[model samples]
Target: MIKIPGEKLIWMYKTMLKIRHFEDKIHRLFLEGNMPGTIHLYQGQEAVAAGVCANLERSDVITSTHRPHGHALAKGVAIKSLMAELFARSTGCCGGKGGSMHVGDPDVGMIPAIAIVGGGIPVATGIALAFKFQKSKRVAVSFFGDGACNEGSFHESLNMGAIWNLPVIYVCENNLYGASTSIRVAVKIRDLAERASSYGIPGVVVDGNEAISVYQATSKAVERARGGQGPTLIECKTYRRGGHSRSDACNYRDKEEEKMWLTRDPVVILRERLTKDGILTPEDSKQMEKEIEEELTQAIHFAENSPWPKPEEALEQVWA
Candidate 1:
């Protein structure tokens, strides 16, 4: 197992916690009719975002999917801005133009997440293309669900990255089901990573619930990309604790399948490893959670007190 730095481990812990609490608040707010629009919570898949982001520099770019709260938080977007956006407030990161699924902060190198399935793949490839063309060392990373692997853009983007040796990392968070359809039934290939072979780039599978494993996998891929070694496809085998969106009950899933994944909860796995390895104490973990909860409370208050976007302003940002 790769040894993560103490500071980096703590940062990853905080990032994951922020994601967890942010989404939890969103779930509550949506339930109470305080929020509009659908939400794709990133509750169970926090570690993948934290781990991959921990390996990236401020200059490196990341593209996110519909389920992007975790990625946005891990990429350094402000909690206040995120909550405001969720509430459709004018002070949001995108000035309320982008809502829950589109949360992002360009100052931190993240574009508004592409809510469309597999939409980020080509955009990330384009960002990498620009960096490659400019001879910049920055790498672009894309976060997409397993369903995205079957999309046409996935193949086209990977081929473009390989053919040009562009600096990109394609991450498939294989949470088994793509909005109710299981990967077993959706794709012919057993591993999503195997598809990278067709593009002549490296691909591998990792325990997405394990932050250390994900960090290590992403570090190497980032390094390879920075060296102009082209792209890598990483299939993170994980599970989503929540349903596809606010309305989904996940009735299509099996009880046994849900039970099995609940045992592999990423936060629990990380906390255990931290305690067992003498990196953190149980009290420390609890303290961290409380601190995060307090911050989230403040974020909600900030968002609630903020003003909603003005109706007339909508036409201002519209393009012909």
Candidate 2:
């Protein structure tokens, strides 16, 4: 397992807590008619984003999915701006254009997240291509779900990355279900990482709920990419605790499956690990959660009071 420094571990905890609370608030806000747009909460898969991003530098890039709040927070997007963006205000991360699915700040090394399932896979490849042409060592990581593996872009991106040896890491957060469909019904292969070998790249499977394991796997992939070796595919075994989107009921998931995942809650596991390793006390963890909740409350107020973008503003950013 990769050993993170005290400061970094604390940062990870803070980020994860922020995502949890922020999404929880968004859910409430949407239900109460205070917020617009549909949301796909990142309630359970916090460790996957945190661990993968921990190995990335500020200049390094990453792509996110429709459920990208965790990646946005982990990649250093400011919470206030993210909340503002969700509110469709001018002060938002995208001037209110990107909204929930596209929340990102390139200034912080995160490109606006690609909402399309596997769209960002090739985009990440392009970013790595740019880095390679410039002889720079920045790595580009792509975050996609298990469903994206079946997309043509996934295959194309892997083939190109392997042939050119682009500095990219494909992270598949195999959360068991893609939208409302289970992976069992979608594909025959149980391990998405195995697809990596078809492109002549290394594929690793990691315990996505365990932050340490995810961090360690990502570290090696990042290093190999920096050393001009090539891309790698990391399939993180995890489960999404919520529906694919606010509209989803997840009627397809069995009660037993949900119960099994709840038992492996990422946040609970992290707290337990930190306490056991002597890196943090239970009290310290509680304090962190408290602080994050307070900050999120502030973000909610900021978004609430912020003015919406003027109607005429649509003509400004467009290139028509």
Candidate 3:
């Protein structure tokens, strides 16, 4: 276990809570028909983004998948701008161009998310190539789901990354199901990290629910990549407690399985550990939650009051 400082742990806790509350609010907004566009919520897998991003610098860039808000938040994107993006306001990070699935901010080093499955793999690889050519220590991270592993781009990008020793970290946020389909039905092998061996790169499997473990694994990977060693494939074993999309009811999931992952809720797990280890008291946790609620409230208010993009300006940001 990486011995994270008490203050850092609390900050991680806050990030996880922020992600949870953000998703919770989004879910309600979608249900109430106030929000436009569909969302792939990142409720239960907050720790993966929180932990991995904690190891990255602002100069480090990350390309996110369709389910990207957690990564955006963890990478230091402003909540107000993110909420505005979700609400389709012109004051958004992408000027209201990239909606829910495409939420991100260049100022924060998170590229506009690629909603297509496995699409960001090549883009991230290109970024690594850029970093290498510039001889910069900066790294690029690709955040994808289990489903992307099956894509051809995953293998090609990994092979190229390995051969060139690019400073790229491929993070697989395995939340059991790739949308509504389970991983078992997709890949015969159990451990997604094992695929790294074929590409001659280091692969690691970590408890995505445990922030410390994730931090340790990513820290090592980042160090190696910065040294011009190579890329790393970190598959974080996690589970999402909700449906894959806005309309999914998760009827395909087993009740017992859902219960198991719910018990392993990253936020709750970290909160318990923080309190039990004498790092935080119950009161302290509650205070943190209270603060996060205020932040969420303000973000939502900002989004609601933000301006919308003009109809004619839509084509301005688009490529001709």
Candidate 4:
């Protein structure tokens, strides 16, 4: 385990808690028909988002995939705005336009999530190019699934980023399966980070369930990026506890595999580590959970009380 400040450790735990609780609430809302659209929950992969974003500056930007709530929250997006967006209320970050899959707040450095498998790759590369053009130290991160590794955009963007030495970090949250298709069946290589060598950039694989481990890997990658060394491909070996989407029952997954990953749940692992380290106590953990619940309640109330966007406003932000 890398040495981390007690405060940072606590923050990571809290962030993971928030993501878990938020996803749990969203799951219930979707099941009860309270939410407007389909959602790809981010239940088990909280550590990846918390650790990676913790190493970034406020000016640094990130592009997320369908599973973006964790990324949005980790990047400092307001909980109220996210809840409003999910509820399809006018006060949402996107004026209730972007539903579950498209949640983001650019003011907080997150681009509205692109639902396409590898869609955000090129966009993040472009953002990194802009940063280089402006001679800024800012970095752009693209968070994608292992399925995107096979996409042409992923290859092209990596090639461009490598050749131009753009300050970018490509984070592959390899959650064992990409929408029910196991990585074993999808790719030949065991480690996705190995693909980075083709672009002549550094490749790293880390235990994504361990927040400190992820933070360490991201810290090194960010330092290299800020120093103008070019891009890095970091493969985070993690797992998603829930189905790919709300409708999926994950019947394709083996029961033992699910049980094994559940045992390594990132939130539970981190909380245990914190408690064992004396950085957090049982009472403190309970208090944190209570506070997160209260915050979620407030956000839900704000979303429910807010009015829906007028029909006329639908095409206002659309650009053709």
Candidate 5:
């Protein structure tokens, strides 16, 4: 039983809807050959981003993994700017330099998402250190796949964050696969959160497909971090409704497994929960859906007409 403010509940549902529609549209754009480069979509795992971010402030920073569109949007990045980034338009958050996997906006409390596996772990830990040194109460969160847990950076980052009592939350989106490889075959332990005990920090497992559960877990961790209780490793057990990337067909996963997770779809779950409680009626659902559609339509239009960066400007953002 998770209790959230009525307005916050609706906001969470809307955020999940936005992520769903945004990723769906991105998949379409890629198929139509209108989008540049390959994409690692955050289709089914909307709950992780929306749930966690609902408890955060605009000033609280977060770091994202390759699948970052959801996190960017959840953290308050403008939809138009995000769509433009996917389109490689000059109006993008990274000025057309960061597309798809690199989607982020510092203005919205997200740095350009780290495309490398386990790369952002140490970066986020460092950001937490900086926050501590500056005496700022702000917290930093790092979102990574379960595969990142095996990386040395993950171990080092967790250890360092624990020892320093850094204000960071390590969110492991255990979608059960590190790309095409299954988590079952990779790690001996089914629950990755258990590894946090080695570092003496709180490790939690949450229903990542359920927005309320994820929100509650994150809210507690955020509160603890804000009170200087150190970092928490939250492992969210969820599934990626789509392939690992544009080139992946996800043929390796069992049909039954995908079907099971699909039934627990985050967006649908939230809507039903709200509707069941009479917080959201049939008409309210329709209105929310319509508004989201309109917003996404505007985002697409903005991306379509946006300008591209000049060829000469490529070297401008690069450092020698």
Candidate 6:
């Protein structure tokens, strides 16, 4: 087991709880018809975001996918702003425009998430190129799904990042299925990390269910990027607890496979580990949960009370 500071462990644990609870709240809201648009919940993959973002500095930016709430929260986006965005309120991070798939706050170092498949890969690479040009040590991380690995943009971006030694990391969260398609059906390679060899960059695979494992891998990749070595591709093998979208029943997934992954729930694993290691007391854990619930409740209230955007405000940010 990798040694992590107790404080950091607690932080990761809290973050995972926040992501889980936030998604649960959103799920309920969506079902209750209180939220507009749709959501891609990050219920089971909380460890990946918490672990990876813990290694990043406030200056290091991350590009997110359509499933962005976990990334946004881990990257320090305010819960209230994100909730407001889902509520389509004027006070949202995107002023009620970006909604669920586009949640982000650049002041906190996350670009508004790109909903298009594999779209953010090249964007993150470009940001890394800019970082290199300016001689900054900051890194850019692109979080994409397994489906995105096959996209032409993924290949081109990796090639460019490798050639220029860009300060970037390509994190592929392989949750087995992309939408309704299994990764086995889409890609021939058993290990997606193998794709990195073609570009001459280091490739790594980690247990996405283990926060310490992910943090350690990201730390190494970030160190390499800062040293001007090049980009690193880290594939996190995780599973999503929920369906792909709001309407999905997940009937396509096998019950046995779901049972297996459920046993390894990241949040529960970490909490137990911390308790057993004497790093977290039951009292402390309970307090943390209470605090998170209160925080989320306050965020919901803020979003519910926030005013909607004026009709003309929609035209303000349009460029084309």
- TM-score against truth, every candidate: 0.97, 0.97, 0.98, 0.98, 0.98, 0.98
For model 4, residues 77-194, the per-residue Cα lDDT tens digits are: 8999999999999999899999989989888899999999999999999999999999999999999999999999999999999999999999999998889799999999989999
Model 6, range 153-213, lDDT digits (tens) per residue? 9999999999999999999999999999988889999989999999999999999999889
- Better structure of 3 and 6 per TM-score: 6
CA-lDDT, candidates in order: 0.91, 0.90, 0.92, 0.94, 0.92, 0.95
Q: Superposing every Cα of model 4 onto the true structure, what RMSD results?
A: 1.0
Residue-level lDDT of model 2, residues 119-199, one tens digit each, is 999999999999999999999999999999999999999999999999999999999888888899999987999999999
Top of the candidates by lDDT = 6
The collision pairs in model 6 are none
Model 5, stretches more than 4 Å misplaced? Answer: none
* TM-score of structure candidate 4: 0.98
| lDDT string, candidate 5, 167-216, tens digits | 99999999999988999999999799999999999999999999999999
Instruction: Decide which is better by lDDT, 2 or 3.
Output: 3
Error of 1 at 54 (Å): 0.3
* Pairs of residues at least 3 apart in sequence or in different chains that clash in candidate 3: none
- State how far residue 260 of model 1 sits from its true place (Å): 0.7
Off by over 4 Å in 1: none
